[model samples]
Structure formats: C-alpha cells, structure tokens
Target: MNESKPLVEGAHFPLALSRPDLIPAARYSDPDFFALERDHLWTRTWQMACRLEEIPRVGDWVEYECLGRSVLVARVGEEELRGYHNACRHRGTQLGVGRGHSPNGFTCPFHGWCWNLDGSNRAVFAPEVFDPALLEPEALRLAEVRVETWGGCAWINFDDRAPPLRASLEPFATYHDALGVDRMHAESWFETIVPANWKLVAEAFMEGYHAEQTHPQLLARSAKSGYSAGTDPLGFVDPEDIVGSSLYFMRTLSEGMGGGMVHARDIEVAEELVRMDLPDDPVEALSEWTTRLNDEIRSRASAEGADMPDLNALLSSGHIHSVNFCFPHFWYLPVYGNAASYRIRPISPEETRFEVWTTTLWPAGDQASTPREPTRRPHDDPNWGEVLRQDFANLPRLQRGVRSPGFDAMRLARGVEGTIANFHQALDGFLAEREHADLLPALHGVSGPIDAPIRDLGL
Candidate 1:
C-alpha cells in the first residue's frame, strides 16, 4: 500500500525512471489498471475476514465485500464460519444492513425469507407456487462460498475451489503459534474515508522509507536512533540495527521475536527494542507494554477530540498487534507483544475502506486478564486522530501527484526503501500471475536496489 512518486515538492524534479518495467503512474491514475486489479488480484486472492471469535455461537454472522460482491459470513457452530452472497433469496435485497447480531438465523428485512446459520433456506416467503423447487432446499437456500481460518482469522473465497488459505500463506504457519490471535479481543477501531486507492493505504505501512517524511509524530522519536531499514535480495522488509542512537519502539519486538533471516525481521528487532522494559517472557512483556502505550494515546487523543475508547480498548488488549503485515493486504499488527489484529480492505479502484478487526488471546469461556468492564464508544481520538488525519491529508495528495504529466517514476534509497519494495514484490508476483494483470509490463525493468546481501559486521 506504500509508494513513492516520480517527483518531489518545491525542488528540481529528478525523473528517476529506475524501474523501467513498471508504467510510471499506472497504479495511481489508470482506470484500466484498477479494473484489472479488481477482476484478477482481489477476486482471486484469499482475503482476511472475521476472526473466529467474532461469531462464537451458532447463527452469528458478519458481512464482507470484495470484487463488487457482498459476502455474508455466518457461523453455524464453533467450527464453521461460512460466506454467502449477502442477498436475500426472495427479494434480492441485502440480507443484513451494517453489522448486527443475528442469534440463530438471518431473516431478510425485505420479504422475511429466513436462512439458517448453515445458509440453508429454513422458511421461504411464498412456498407454494414454485413448491417443487421451493421444497427442494437448494432452490430457496442462500448461495454459499468458501471459508477458512488461520492465525486466529477467518478467510473466505467466492470461488469454492480457490486454494486453501494455508497454501497461499507458505512458510508462515511456523510462526503462527507465537501470534496468539485466538487469545485476543477487540480494543478499538476507526475508519478513514480515504480519497485514494487501497494501495495508497497500504503504502503507508509497506516501509519505513517515508517514516521521517510522512509520520512526523513517530519521527520525533524514530529519527533519534539506530535504524537502517532496507530490502534484502529477495525483497523482504529489512530492518537492521539502526545506525545511530535514535530508535523506535517496535525494534524491541522485532529483535525479541525474530527467527526469520528475512526483511521484516528488522521490524521484529524494532519491537523488541520498544519492549526493552518488558518481562522475561517477551510475549508477556509485549502485552503489558502495548496496553499501557495504547491507553495513553487513547486518553490523549480523546482529550483532543479524536479518541474512540471502545475501539482503543479493542486495540489495547495486548493480544492483537503482535503480528504486523500478516499477509499481502492485511496487517496483523500486534502493537502489544501479547496479541495480534487484522487490518484489511480491498482497493475498489480509487476508493477503499479499511476494516480493522481486533482480538485478544482470550477465547469464549476463557477468563481474560483485563477486567470485563462496560465498553464505551466514542467519536474520535485527538492524539492518534491527528496521526491519521495527517496521513489522510497527505496520501490523497500523493495519489493526485501520480497523474501529473511531469512525474515519471520513483527512486528508492537502499536502507529506507525495504518495506515499500517488499510490498511491491508481493504485488508484482500477484500481477504477473493474474490473467487480467497486463500491468506487469510497466514494472519490468526496475533495477535492484541492493545486491544479494548487505550485512554490517558480516555475521
């Protein structure tokens, strides 16, 4: 989701057409490019849906939409979280509005054709006229799609035969046990109606390249230390020990949980540095620290007119945020070491909606360490609210710049560009494989930023 442009501000324009394979600004301004992404990339990809805990009981349901289709997720029991088309069988109206609880079945508001939790038609509006097909369970039944869950998340595909979620997430399962996704609960969530594509949203998280430039609040501390983030030969999010004294909080977590000798490993190190004061059990240390930091920001944000407490509580649980960038489009950012969360949304052309699903380690029937208190909802958070406001202010501007005939391409620095490139590598892979993605031709000639390996001290 993170990106760089072909030009800069109030300065001499340096046309860095380094990556010749990619069309300079196709992702930003091209409607055809967006169409291809919608048709091939999103529809074919397995997406992060609700966490298994969201609908713990039979008949619980959640809604999902991608590729212009609204998907309804329902749980018939503890084990099943299934997807439907979200349309009522009778009137063709959306079965559910925003999001609410449906105890045992979803009765359409249109004509009252009720569907069981298993997606079967339990009661048809008019059962007699087409009685032959009406009585034939399948005819009146809601259309079912594919569902799968992993790393404490639920995923669904409209194509029943799409590869299982596990197959798509290769070599990632080994680290799943550390995520503790199932033990988490929601802390807080807020949405930004961004005027850019979903890729713009992702670009923010893709790398630390823009940290100093885009995130001044975080840079106040991050700029002070030993951080040199870049890409490895394989294009991973590489965070090495920082060069100087200033460092960010995430370094602690990264160093603590690091096992992979890949790019994102640096983030693990950064997080570990952040949690330096945490307990011996890095997980416990991570959880405690997250709750404290998240709460502080929430309190300050609310005081400023931008705090959303209920959402903050969901985020501060310490269980979510441990896992960052869990997949291509979603970020399982466990701000605390103890928990993890799911941040995902499809880029519908120039518009995108971000869904932040939070969770704690505690499952149904399990006791949570944090006392169960009345959850309060709020309108905004000032401290963190300003943070996002800043992003929203800038991203759309970046999206706008891609359209100018003056700009050509971007030039990424070695250390600061890793996260951005890692994301692009993933996107490139998807585009190359997609039949609709003829966009690969635009990015073919971009040269490598770093050679095979750039290690300090040559371990």
Candidate 2:
C-alpha cells in the first residue's frame, strides 16, 4: 500500500499513518499504558471542568473528579473563579461533594478545619493545643489548581507549568471565537457511563465514514446517494473519494461528506421530509434553509436587543464546520445553526463517562426554556436521539474486538480515516514526550531533533 501525505502535517502529528504500527491496540486495554496516560495525558493537560453557568452564584462550587483525582471549581466573587485540589489540609478529607452553594465556605466534616471561598485557611478548632510554630495557618491553605475561562466554560489544569488555555488551544479558540459561543446557551446536556475504553468512545465521533453503515437514516436527506449503492465494500460512500477538496474541505474546515447539493428527484426522501417547506433539491435546500434560518435568527436576536454574532460569515467563507479535536478529551463540532460538543473521561480501564452537549443561539427570552443541569443516564435513554444511540452501540463491541488475540492492530483506511490517524499520531506524540528524552545522550554526536529516527521507523 502506498502512503498518503499526512493531512495534519506538523510537530503535533508526526507519524506517517499508512504504517500499521500507528495503531497501538494495547493503549486501549493495557493497565500499564493506562497508568502512563493518567500520568502524562490526564495530569499535564487542561480539562473542561464545568460551564460558567453551572456555578453562577457566588460560593457555588462544582466538584469535577476523573481518574481518581478530584478538583473543586468555585465562584468566590462576582466574576472570580478558583480551583482547588478538593482535599482539606488536615487529615486529607474531601472538601465538597457534588454541586452546591457554600455561603460560609467549605468546612471539612472529618475535622473542624474550614477553608474560605478564596481557598484560604479560615479557622481550625483546638488551635491552641497545637504548636503555632508547627501549625501555621498560612501553610494549611488549600492547594490551588490553575483555573481559566473561555467560551463560557471554566477549565482546570493540574500542571502549573502547562501553557495558558488559549495558548494550548490556538486555532480551536480562534475558530470558536468567530461564532458567538459565549452568547450561546446550553440547550441540552446529557452524560452516560459507557462500558468501553475512553479512547474507543472518543474515536467513534472523530470520523464520518461510519455514518452510512451505522446511521443509514441520514442518507434519506442525501440526493447523491438516494437509494443508490455506495462505492466501498462497507456499503458506505467515502467523502474524500469524491466531492469537495480532499485536503482542506472536510479534513480541515469545511462540512463533512454530505455537504454537496441534494437531488430533487431522489426516491429515498421520506414523505414527511418531502412535504416540508424545503425546496425540490434537499441538500442545497438544507444549505439555503440553514442560511435563511440564521438570517431570521439574526433578525430576531436584533429585534429582541440580544447580541448575536453573524455565523453566516462562516457559511460564506466555506469555513462552515469548525470540527476541532482538542487534545486529550474534548471534541467541538460547531456549525452555522446547530452545534454539538463531546467530552470523554475514564472511569477505569474498561468504563468511561461520555458527555454530550448541544448548543444553539436563542433570544434572551428563551432562557426560561433552557434545559436543566445535565444528568447522567444510560446510553439507551430516549432523550439521546437515534443518531447518538447508533454511534454508542458499537463502542463496547470495538472494545471487545480490540482485545482479541486474533486482532493485533487496526489497518486504518488512511484516505477516509485521516482524522482518526491524526488523533492517534498526536496521542503518540504525547506518550513519546519523555521516552525521546532518554535517547538524547545516545545521539550526542548527531545533531537536530531525535524524533526523525523514531518517525522514520514508524515507532
């Protein structure tokens, strides 16, 4: 097989994905690999802890726990957010549980020690009994974790040396900033415990190649594939094989496979879809409809004296789908009218928590109808919708298949699965950070970076 040029070519994803070694199946099941990931990927990266709206009032706090580590994000003042390790200084007791408003700040139940909302040591009982020199109140302050806010959400990082949130997430922040993300509300939020590795759950959404086989209902709106046979053996149409620019369209900034024009004479459209206000051609009709809908939304938001950004600019520029895979655990799929985002966290080597949040712009008046705080439920819950259910149904099977002795590694379809390859390559970059350092002395006589050797060998 010939190797295709890496779509996301850079220091982030250095591996040539055509090589089979890029798929390290053990990373999905091995406890030792999981431990290494917990040490490097989880701790050294910034995580989206909670939305700013979730803790709107002063003294309100949300406990974000993952992989045996916990953090408490609290609103100490009107606009100030702070994060702490969630453990008391005395006897190492958890400071808070779940979400609540602590007016007088958090008081440890195990001991009488209290920490102020600002994470300062407030008071400890029996202070006189302990030596003041040995027990300085200043030394007993809650350990603080770095906290920052962007796109109306609070992010926490355990590593003090980690770069600022904006710096760490460059083009992603730039892309999301174009759309009025701060102005959008969390229309719906849901979470579920999936019985699959965290990586397996995340990879499901990174590519659209599985849509035809997994979500055949989506083809009803496609004019090109209107009851037509797909080209590939999997009975799914490959976007890169036809339609749109292979390099920049779907791979970088544009919409996914079905962005082309819709067929008017196609027989696949359902009776309900055919009778709708859409035009004769459904695909172009959907695009035009999306533009008109955004125009109406802009007018309504203006009429209601609400501040909303012009998302139509993205549509015009062909930067319509700002699909970004923020490293470690977040996926932001921001479109012109509707947006969906996902977060995955590991509960163990086998179970992971998957979070789905859908966002839309609504006039300020619609705030009353905004969905409630996200509640965790099973994936089969009716509220998850059909497409999501279909996507999740394959995760456990993937987990089981990857562990089989017959399957050594995955042969990635580089043409269509480039995004997934980029993800795996980036993950390898993270895992190789320290391993490459140990080889520096071996190349004392050699010059330049040491990664060239590793990348060439497909390591």
Candidate 3:
C-alpha cells in the first residue's frame, strides 16, 4: 500500500529565490494591480460556476458574475450541461438574471429574441428587420463558453486554450476524488461581502500562523504545547489523550508547516462534539474511531442501497485537510468528507465579494428536495461563529494598515506562509504575461524540481 504524502511535505514546496520576502503593500490596495488581475488572470482561468446540484434538472440554470464578466451555466439534458456568456445576441441584454428554470429557452426581455437551452437561436422576433446574414442561426445564438463538471461542481473557462480543470488541479483532484466531494451535498451556504482586497482575504486562511493572535480561543486548551512562538506546537502530554479533544486531536493529525499542526476554527468546533476524556491509548482510540465510523457509514449506505467509499483506508494513510487554491479566485479546504470553500470576487482594490460554502457527505436516504439559493449575510452574522467573525473583522484592518505610509511591504514567514509566497510568485508570472505552462516554474525561483509532485499541481 502506498502511504499518503503530507500536503506540505518538504521537497514539495519550492522557493522562488529571486522573489522578494516582502510582498508589496500596493498589490493589496492598488486599483491598477486589481485591473491587471481582471484582465490577465480572471479572464484566463477556470472558475467554479455552481454546484451540479444547483442546476440538476434540464433547463435549470445558474448565473455566475465576477470581475465584470458574467457566465450562465445550464443543464439542457439529463446529462448535458453547457455555459454561455450571459448576454443576448440582440441588443446586448442579459439573457438570465440570477437562476431559474427556462425549459423552453431564454427570451430577451428587451427585444424578445429567444435562445434554446443549448444556446442556439430559437427565434428572432423580427428577423426581417435586420439583414439576412446577420440573422443567421450562428450569429443570433448566445455566445457559448467552455463548461465542464467535476466533483459535483460546474466549472467554466473563458479562455479557449485553457487546459482541462482536472489537469489544472492535479494532485489535489486526487484528494478530492478519494473524499468523494462529488457525492457530498451542501449542508449550509452563505456569502459575505468583505471590505478588503480579495488577496488579503484569501491569504488570511492560507496558514495557521495567525491563530495565536487572530483566534486566541483555539489555543485556550489546557494543553501545554497548544501555542508555540507563532505556530501551534501540537505537543500534548499524552499522544493518546489527544484523541478525545476536538482541536487537540485533529490538530495532532493535521500536519502543516515544519511538520507542526495547524488549527482552524471549524476544526476547533468540530472537535468539541467528540468525547475529550482521557483514553487508555490515544493512538488506538483514533484508529478505532476511524474504523467504527467508516464501518457505520458503509453499513448505512448498504442498507439504503447507496454507494460510499471506505474513506477510513484513505484517512489512515494520511488524510490531512487539503488546501487547494484554484488560481485567480477559488479556494477549497477539504477535510475527510466535509469541505469549506471560499470564493473571492474583486469588486475593486478595497472591496470584494467573499463567499463561504460548506458541504458534507449526504446521509443515505436523505437528500434536499429543493435547490438552495445562497444566503447573503454581514460579516458579524451570528451564524458565521465568533472565530470566523474575528477573521473577517481583521481583514479590513489589514487592508487599511497596508495603505499606511509607514508600511511599504509584507514580511512573509516562509515556513508558515510558503503557499502564500508561492501564490505571489505565480501572480507575478501572470502579471508578466507568461503562459500557464511557464508560469508555475516561477515558484521555484526559475524551474522547480523535475520530479517535484507539486510543481505541476500548482499547489
């Protein structure tokens, strides 16, 4: 059996030698930088449009708008899904607003020209009113965009030459495949508008370095090694005793920078539900818990005639939370069968539409009967929890602080913030107008290790 490799394992992270240790303050608050991203990055990457369940039925559609560009994804048949630019061929009117069933097709509210679910022209109200050549079916049809579905989500790419989504998301896709995120369903969903640069909001969750300050409650555990210099030591008195406590146990197993553990608020709260009482053997308890949980799920699935993988096998090998940033704007954090996702849409240099989505494996015999529309909430919404709220509040302040005359750049902690630094290197490559094929090498200062697994994975 192949042992699972830790996500942040050494020899996997590359250093861009020429890259500055200090990230420019302007990158976070400069409108010009944001514009460069809109023009070069967002326009060329594969972006998550909607969950497949959101448009499960034929004719059901969802519209995704980002960086002043809008796309419409629709299901045209039981297995057919397609995407198009969300504008009418006629007077440049929008074909769909938000989301709904348009079984017959989309009709332009402005001119009544209609488009079929396949984006083909169905009828033009006044065809003779224009030249015959201009009224050709191809000319009148909605401009089609590339769309693909994987892991229960529909992804769209505006660039015609963009590589397949799976290729762009390699090794991470391997993790998502094992967890079967495609089989999971949304448990709760919401988006919050944060008054901060998108990059500022994204970088906040990329590392656990901030837990000692941003989320002090997480390290409030009585465990001695709960908090280290700036990172969590994750050293418990009894390794076996750690299994029962939520944060302590999971943090014990969820490896991060320098082989130390990292803690996030969701993981902290999740740990609370499990018994924290002392165990005879912490390691054995964790092993048993994983075995029993996997068995229970398998049994339930069999009884319900549903299908589920034996994730215990996968988890045992090395199932740390996988943090994957699908470049330009999407971030996915998948742990076991549950995931929390973030999508950052830039409205301007200082404003962004930050979306947070959570999904978990659906229990056998239970499924939502209706599609869910995302709920928009303020940063302080009680539903987001105190820890999450704390992170949200810190972001805007960070944005403001970066703008201070005294602040020139950011000093990144390479061990803890390697991923963030790698991201900036990738961003610089894009801003320099390099192709994706050549861009990733910038992560290694020039070219990364030829056999480096993460070199192509785009971390």
Best by lDDT: 3
Candidate 3, residues 26-108: lDDT per residue as tens digits?
78887777787788778877788888889988999999998878998999999999899988887798888999999998999
Q: Residues 1-459, candidate 1: write the lDDT tens digits.
A: 024532212111222222422335656556766665666466666777666656666766777766567888777776767788888877689997545567677888876778777777888766676657446777778887788887766787655545666665543443444444444555444454456777667666545545556554443222323233321112211222121112343432223222111113234343444534545442454445445555544444345443233434554343222324534566654433233333546555666665443343322233322322212222132333343445556767777787678865544444445445444444544444433222222122111221111111100
RMSD of 1: 12.3
Model 2 lDDT tens row, 275-394: 335444434454554455456556655666656577577767555553456666776666543356778899898899998776655453533455546777897666556667777788
lDDT of 1: 0.50
Show where candidate 3 strays beyond 4 Å. Answer: 1-20, 220-244, 247-306, 364-371, 440-459
Ranking by TM-score: 3, 2, 1
Shift in Å, residue 1, candidate 2: 17
- Alpha carbon lDDT of each predicted model: 0.50, 0.63, 0.65
Candidate 2 vs 3: which has more lDDT = 3
Clash numbers, per candidate: 85, 1, 3
Q: Can you tell me which runs of candidate 1 are displaced by over 4 Å?
A: 1-23, 131-135, 216-323, 339-342, 346-348, 357-389, 413-459
